[model samples]
Target chain A: MADIVLDKVSKSFPDGTVAVRDVDLEIADGEFVILVGPSGCGKSTTLNMIAGLEDISSGELRIDGERVNDRAPRDRDIAMVFQSYALYPNMTVRENMAFPLRLAKLDRATIEQKVAEAAKVLELTPLLDRKPANLSGGQRQRVAMGRAIVRSPKAFLMDEPLSNLDAKLRVQMRTVVSRLQKQLGTTTVYVTHDQTEAMTLGDRVVIMRGGAVQQIGPPQELYDHPANLFVAGFIGSPSMNFLHAAVEEERLRTAVGDVPLGDRLRRELAAEDAPRELILGIRPEHFEDAGLVDEQTRGRGTEFEAPVEIVESMGSDKYVYLTVSGERASAAELEELAADVGADGFGGGAANLVTRLSAESTVAEGENRRLWFNLEKIHLFDPSNGRNLTLHEGRAAGALAS
Target chain B: MAASDTTVAAKWRWGLLDVVVVVFALVPVLWIASLSFKTTGTLTDGNFVPREWTLDNYRTIFSTNQFVRALGNSIGIALIATAVAVVLGTMAAYAVARLDFPGKKALVGVSLLIAMFPQVSLVSPLFEIERSLGLFDTWPGLILPYITFSLPLAIYTLSAFFKQIPWDLEKAAKMDGATSGQAFRRVIAPLAAPGVFTTAILVFIFCWNDFLFAISLTSTERSRTVPVALSFFTGESQFEDPTGAICAAAVVITIPIILFVLFFQRRIVSGLTSGAVKG
Candidate 1:
C-alpha cells in the first residue's frame, strides 16, 4: 500500500469549465479516502486525474512519493472499478481478474494462482469461468473490486461502483466493500455522490461543492460539527434543519414566540456571533416530545405553537414536518424557519421539508396541531457567510446555544 | 399519465409504419431476384413473372473468361482490402478512442477528412500517386486505394464503439500488470470483435462495388474486378445474350456479397445503430 497525494492540483477543460480547483489532499497510506459530492462537483474528475485517465491540467500527483504526472495509467499502478463494473463481458471472471497479471507478462501458473486467491476473497470461486453477463449485479460489483485488488496495486480507485445496483444490493455490497477495504487495507480513493456511502465507507471523507473542496475530515467530524452550511446540508441523512432567527434583547426572537436563553447558551452564542442575525441549525434527532401530559420538560423548553404538516414513520424514528404561522422566511432560511413553524404551514417551501422530528416526540400530520422545539440543541450560523457560529475548540467542544 | 399514454399510442402507430416500410423496401430486391431467372425476351415483358425459365444465363456466365477472371479479382481485392482496413482501422480507432497522444486531434481530423470526401473526387490524384509508385494496375494499387478511402469510415464508426467500452476495463487490465497495448489486445479487442467485424463488412462492400477506381486503375483481365467484367455482357462483338444469361451472370456475381452480408449482417446493423444513436 502507498500514500497518494494530490499537490495543489487543478483541472480546467478546454471549454473553460474548471472541473477541480486547487485541490490539495494527502491520502494516508492504507487509508480509504472517499471523494463525495453531488454531480458536477468534480469528485470523479479528481479520482480520474489521479488514475491518469484524465490529464492533470496543473500540479503534481505522487504515489508513494514518486511523481506520476507523466506516467501512463498502466505505469501508474492503480486499479479502478467503474459504475458499470466494466467486466470484459466476453471474458470469464478468471480471465477478467487475471487480465492485468497477464499484461504484466507473469507466468500462466502465477496468474492462475492470483486469480484463484482473488476469487476466493470475492466469493467468486464458483464464478471463475462465468462471463460478466452471467453474474448478477452484486457479483459483478465484487469482480470489479476484485479486479482492482487482485494485483495489490499501490492504490484502488472506485467510481460509483455500486451505483447501478438496487437499494438492498447497494447496502449489501456497501458492507462488502467496507469489509474488503479493511481486510486488504489498500490505499483507496473512491468517488460517489451518495452521502451514506461516504459516511459509512471512508476513513476520511472529502466533501466537495462546485468543483471546490468545501471540507475534509472524518465523517462524524463533518456530521457533528460541519465547517459550513454546505457541508452540514450535504453530509447527513435527511440533512440538518436551518431556521433564520435573531437575538433581540438577550431573547431568541422569531415570529412564533420569544424563548428565554440560559446564561450558558447566551454566553456560547455571544462568542459565536459578533453580529445580530444568525442562522439556526438543528438535526432532527435532537428534538424531544413534550407531550401535553408531561410537566418536567413541557413549556420548560422553547415552546412554539406549530401544526404538524406531515409525519414519516421509520420504525425506530419518526420525521415530523411543522409549519409556523405568519413567519415569511427568506428562501435561503426557509428550511430552518419551517422546522419551528406549526405543522399546518411548514412544508410548502421544501420537498424534504425544514425539520425532521424524531420518533417519541415527532408529531404526526394533522395529529399535533402545535409543536415544540428544544432550545439547547439549537445551532446558529452567520446568514451572510453560512459559517456556523461557534468557537470549535475541537469535535468535543459543543456549540453554545444563544 | 394521460400524456404518457399518447406517447405510447404514437409509438404503436410508428411500429405499424415500420411494417409498411419493410414491404416497400423489399419490392426492388424481389423484382431483381425474379429477373435473374428470366430469359432476355421475357425480361423486358410488361408482366412481373417470366413466361419461360432457363439456366442458359448461368451456363453463359460460367463459360465466359471475362466473368470468371473478374470474379477471382474481386474476391482477392475485397479480402485484401478488408484485412488491411480492419487491422489498420481497429488499431487507429482504439488509439483515437482511448490513448492520449500529442497529435490525437490531428489524427481524428485526418480520419474525418478521408471519410467526408466523395471517393470519385480523389480518383485522378490517387491514380497519379499509384502510377508514380509503380503500383498501377496491380492488386496493391486497388488495395491501396481501397484502404485510403475505407480507413476513415471504419475508424469513425469503430471509435464510437470504443468510447462505449468502459475505460475502467483497460485500467483494470493495467492494474493486473499489463501494458497499454496488451490491455487493448486482450480486453478491448475481444470486446470490439463485433465492431471490427462490422467495419470489415462495410469496407468489403464498398471496395467490391467500386466501379470508377477498378475501371480506371486496372487495364487488363488480370486485375479487373467482376463489375468491370460484367460490363462485357453488353456483347461488343455480337448481339447481347437474352435475359437468362445476364441474370445468371448477375446472380453469380452477387453470391459472395450476399454471403458476406448474411454472415456479418447482425453485427453490422447493431454497429451502425449504436454508432448513429449514440452520436
Candidate 2:
C-alpha cells in the first residue's frame, strides 16, 4: 500500500552506542523486503525505526513520499508482529484482531466484519472466542498475524514473527506468511536473524553487518553473487568453504591443490593492485563427486583428491567433509563470521572442505575421494579486505559500493 | 507397595498440619463471635460456647449513634485512603518498573525505606501537624496519614507485578493504531488489573485495621474509627462492662474485611499475563 524509504537513517543511544548506522533502504510499494543479519547486527533496530518504535538519530524516513520522522506509530499507519507474538492476553482472539479497527473508531459492524475476514484468512475462525491462554503457540502466532492484517495498515513490520514456532511449524507458517503477504499486497519490512527466512520470504533481501548495509539483492542473485566474504559465508547453508590461496604464475596454489586460472579469473588477477595472496571461496553445492560427473561437465571443472573425514546422507545429497594439506582461511571478516555462529576456530587450522555430492556417490568416510569443483563458480576474495575480486562489473559492484 | 504406604502417611501428616494451622487461625475469631453473642452475665463464663446467647449486645451497639458514626467514619476514611493510595501508587510504581530516569534507583530505595519505617514514630509529629493544618479530628486527618503510610506498600507490590508484564504488548498496541494513552488503558491497564486489585485490598486492610494513627489523630466521635472507638466504649451504666458490645462491633468491622478478601481473591490469583508473550 505504500513505499517505505529510509534515507541514511541511523540510531544511536544516549550512551553513545550506535545500534544502526547509515542504513539506506528503498522498499517499493507492495514489495516484501527482508533485513537479515546475525544478532545485534542492527536489523531489528532498523525495523523498529521503520515502525516508529525507535527514534532515528539522523537522516530521514519517508512513507509514500511523505517525511514521517516525527510521526508516532499510530499516525504512521503501520502494523508490527513482534517476535513474542505480544497477544493481548486479556482479549479473546476476536477482540485481539479487532483491536486496530476499534482504535481507528470503526463502527461495530465493520470491525466485526474485518475481524471475521482476517480470522478466516488465518484459519482462526474456530478460535475467535478463545483467549490466547487456551491457544497453542502456532495459533497465537496466527492471531498476531490476524491482528496486523485486520486493519490493512500501510505496511507490516515483522520482527522474527515466525522464529518462536517449532521447526515444522515454522516451515508451515513461512508459506502462510508468504501467501498472506502476496494476497494483501502490502509493503512489508521483515527482520530476521535466520538466513533461510531471508532467502525464502522476501522479494529482495538486504543483508546488514555492524549497523551498516552490506548488500541488497534478490535471493538467488545474492546466493549466486555475494558482494563480500561476509555475504558469501552468511547466505548459504553449511556456508561457503574458505581456503587460503597463494597467487602464482597463471595458477592459484591452495591447500586443496593448484587451481589453474581461467581467462576470467586471470583478467581480474591482472589488475595492478591484485594481491599475491588471496582467499578462495566456493559453496558446498559447487563440489560434486568426481565419479558421478559426466565427461562434458567434468571437463568444465577441476578435480582434486582428499581424505574424507565424514559423510552425511541428507536424503537427496551427501555432505562430505574432506581434509587437505593447507592452512585454514584467515581474515578479519572470516573470523567475525565464525564468531557470529559461535564457531570460533572451527575445525582448527586443518583446512577442511564441506562438499555436497550426489546421494548415489559412494564417498565413504576414511576414503580418498576425488571431488570436482566448478571453476567458473569459484570466488576469489582479497585476503586483507574480504572483497570479492571476481565481482568486477554491473550490479555486484554497485551493491558492494553501497 | 512401600512407596504407596509412605505417600499415604505423608498425606495424613500434611492433613494434620493443615488442621493445626486452621485451628490456630480460626479459634480467636470464633471466640470473638461467641463472646459477641453472650449475655453480659455470661461474658466471663468458662464455657467455649456462649452459656446464654442474646441479641442484646448487637442491639445496644446499633442503638447508639456513637458506634454507628464511628463505623461510618471507618468505612469512609479507609475507602478514600485506599483509592487515593492505589491511584498514586500505580503511577509511581509503573514509572519505577518501566521507565529509566535519573535517580530511579534512589526513588525505589527511598520508597522501600519508607515502607520499613515505623508508623508509630510518625504519629506524634502527624498529630501536631494535622492540628496546625486544621486536619485534626476529621476524616481527612486520619485519611491523610493512612494514605502516606500505605502508599509505599502499594507501590512495592504493584511494581513487582508490573515488572512481569511484557513491554512488547504496549508497542504492539501502538503499532495497531492505538495512541500511547489508548495503548495503556486498553492493553496495559487490563493486564495490570489483578495487581491493582491486589494492591487495593492490601491498602484497604492497612487503612481499616490501623489503631495507632486513628487513636492518636482523633479526639472526637466525628472522626474516630471502630478500633479507636472500641477503646473509648462505655457500658450502658458506669458500673456495667462493655465487653459484649465491644465484641459485637469487632465482629461487624471484620465482616467487611472478609468480604473484600473473598470478592477479589480470585482476581489476585489468576495468572492474567501468562499468554501475553512467548514463554
Best by lDDT: 2
In candidate 2 chain A, where is summed lDDT lowest over 10 consecutive residues? Answer: A393-402
Runs in model 1 lying further than 4 Å from the true structure: A249-251, A259-274, A292-301, A326-364, A367-374, A395-402, B1-65, B91-141, B148-152, B233-248, B262-279
Cα lDDT tens digits, model 1, B1-279, are 999999999999999999889979976666766787777667778566667876666777778788888899999999999999989998899889877889999988987887888878888988899889988899998999899889999999889889877776676566556677777787778678778878888999999998999998988888999877776565424676544555566677778988998898766534221211111
* Model 2 error, position A227 (Å): 0.9
Q: After superposition, how far is residue A13 of candidate 2 from its true place, in Å?
A: 0.3
Best by TM-score: 2
Question: What CAPRI grade goes to candidate 2?
Answer: high
For residues B1-279, could you state the per-residue lDDT of candidate 2 as single tens digits? 999999999999999999999999999999999999999888888677997989999998999888999999999999999999999999999999989989999988888888889888888889889999999999999888888889889999999888889999989998988888898899888888899999999999999999999999999999999999899889879998899999999999999998988888878767798788998
